[model samples]
Target: MKENSTFAPKANALQDYQFTIIVPVYNEEENLPRVEKELLAYTKIASKKTGILFVNDGSKDNSQALIEETCTRNEGFNYISFKENRGLSAAIKAGFDHVETPLLGYIDSDLQTAPEDFNLLLEKIGEYDLVTGVRANRKDKFVKNMSSKIANGIRRAFTNDGMDDTGCPLKVIKTAYAKRIPMFKGLHRFLPAMILLQNGKVLQVPVQHFPRIAGKAKFGVWNRLLGPLMDCFAYLWMKKKYINYEIKSKGC
Candidate 1:
């Protein structure tokens, strides 16, 4: 509930902010300094006024202290800490639950993706409910890239969402649509599909990608390959049972 004061800090106040960029951190102490620098710069040139929300997924390292210090020094940076490790899906879900902006964005703390490219996605968000980045000239290893390709192919066959790279972390989603997504394990892989379930428009724009400059990657080839394959089945189940209803009229 730590609302960024760059906009409106008090309840029932009109928030001037247009977006909240959620950075999910988990034992990424080595990269935090650079992350702070890049994101702070991005905010200055962003298409709309932006706030940073760091969801600490129970990092055992010195990340929480750094996050606290960053928030304290910055005008629009804030964080929420979990009591224990809950994986990436939980971190993202917590972010969605707490975000109050009109638009919400997601980015990894690893810095593989450029924060500045967010403006590119933001430019198109008005016409779509979700705008996700497809990594252009991805700089990952062969195994990593190949595994992701296979996973994406399998996901396409099942979900048929027409997304080239659903694993891209750089994305901007309308807050109303994002909050409706029922997050599960591997929720990140199926974000566009989830938006489709809500009868929302989705677009994928190419963005810059880089190799991991710091911190160990949380996922391996097996994690990248097998985990998403299993999650596709989960998505199928959820899709079958998901409830979507629209009321043309409402009562006060």
Candidate 2:
């Protein structure tokens, strides 16, 4: 396989089967190798056909090169690099756009969420348009954990998605519904609500969490607390004004 090559084997278990896992990466060079190894292991044991799509959000570090090298060596791994740094939402949206698969999934490169637990979400994919991981035991600083808890509580009170961990990186979503979601700066936080906008069902399962073994956290007080607070109002506006319709008649 050539460096930066994008090739994934088609699965034989199911006819027309395709599942893509998108890992949005930014300056996570230290974690890429471990992420690659774990993801490859998970792909082997995944319930359905699987491949990896890494969205390089213009990391200043060696993340892109590592991603390219991994994709070149691993047939199941593929990647796309951005020209400049964009936030996590942009990377995720880019992944959703490029993937051609029945099922689309995402996990952060931070290693805080175990990739193996993706199977926990995938097991329930058949029943829900979105299957999200609820971090069973979050491993973070007290401040970060508390801030996230408050943010999640506020989100649930407003959006009513009833998800305990919308911020959890591990998720499996049906691609058809995922593509219809409107993208915004912080829209990644509202994934469950966006799926709910389409009247799609969402399921949450308990998944393991771990401490970040390397790199710095991308989010701070502004993005974690105040940012989400502002985005909640945006979601409210979108919820009220967002349009959804169905065509009941066939074209002649």
Candidate 3:
């Protein structure tokens, strides 16, 4: 586990929180304001009692201050800050570990995925342990789109998860199942596969995608290409050694 140096949460924040959306921020200072606005609007119209958890992955910019300010004024918003950059998977894992709500969601701070579309995924959450978005007509550069396509194709052949766009940032998962997943580096790309390892059902729904309005993309061609290839081998190894069991009966 990475060091979580700061845990700034409102007292009793989760008491009435039915869902917590984990927003992983890494040097996205330029986009925090809009992120706050979009998320605030989503909270107002979300079907469930929703809260926002911004995981600051040791951002080396003003992102920390912005996240603190956003969480301070927002009633249901909170944050966990790491001592150093821990990447997206660690941030999501931290969110899963700290979430007190029954349902947990995840999105990127880049705002390429709309927060409002979460409702579309939530609609089917009752039937599946995890419901993720499949970006419809992604608005990204040709290199990025092609690399992501190749990566996703390789992952499907390896894991056979049947997810069209695992890289889509929008997702909703039952906290119980999410918490059980043993997260590792690049595990963010394998949420559905990891849920399947727990014998949980996963589904994908088409969602809106937008071009990044601010800040630069974090991943490049190598990260999108070689990264998933290495992670696929990691998943295979994890699947082989993974332990899962069900207790038919328990004594209280």
**Candidate number of the best lDDT:** 3
Tens-digit per-residue lDDT, 1-252, candidate 2: 123223333342223447889999999999999999999998898888788888888799999889878987876677878877778888888888777889989999998888788788888989899999999878899999999999999889889999998999999999999999988899999999999999999999999999999999999878788899999999999999999998899978
lDDT of 1 by residue, 197-237 (tens): 99999999999999998999999987788888899999999
* lDDT at position 135, candidate 3: 95
TM-score of model number 3: 0.98
CA lDDT of every candidate = 0.90, 0.87, 0.93
Model 2, residue 99: displacement in angstroms? 0.8
Per-model TM values vs. the true structure: 0.94, 0.93, 0.98
RMSD of each: 3.5, 3.9, 0.9
Candidate 1 clashes between residue pairs 3 or more apart in a chain or in different chains: none
Off by over 4 Å in 2: 1-17
Q: Judging by TM-score, tell me the better candidate of 1 and 3.
A: 3
In lDDT terms, how accurate is model 3?
0.93
| Best-to-worst ranking by lDDT | 3, 1, 2
lDDT of 2: 0.87
Per-candidate count of clashing residue pairs (backbone under 3 Å) = 0, 0, 0
Q: Quote the lDDT for 4 in model 3.
A: 57
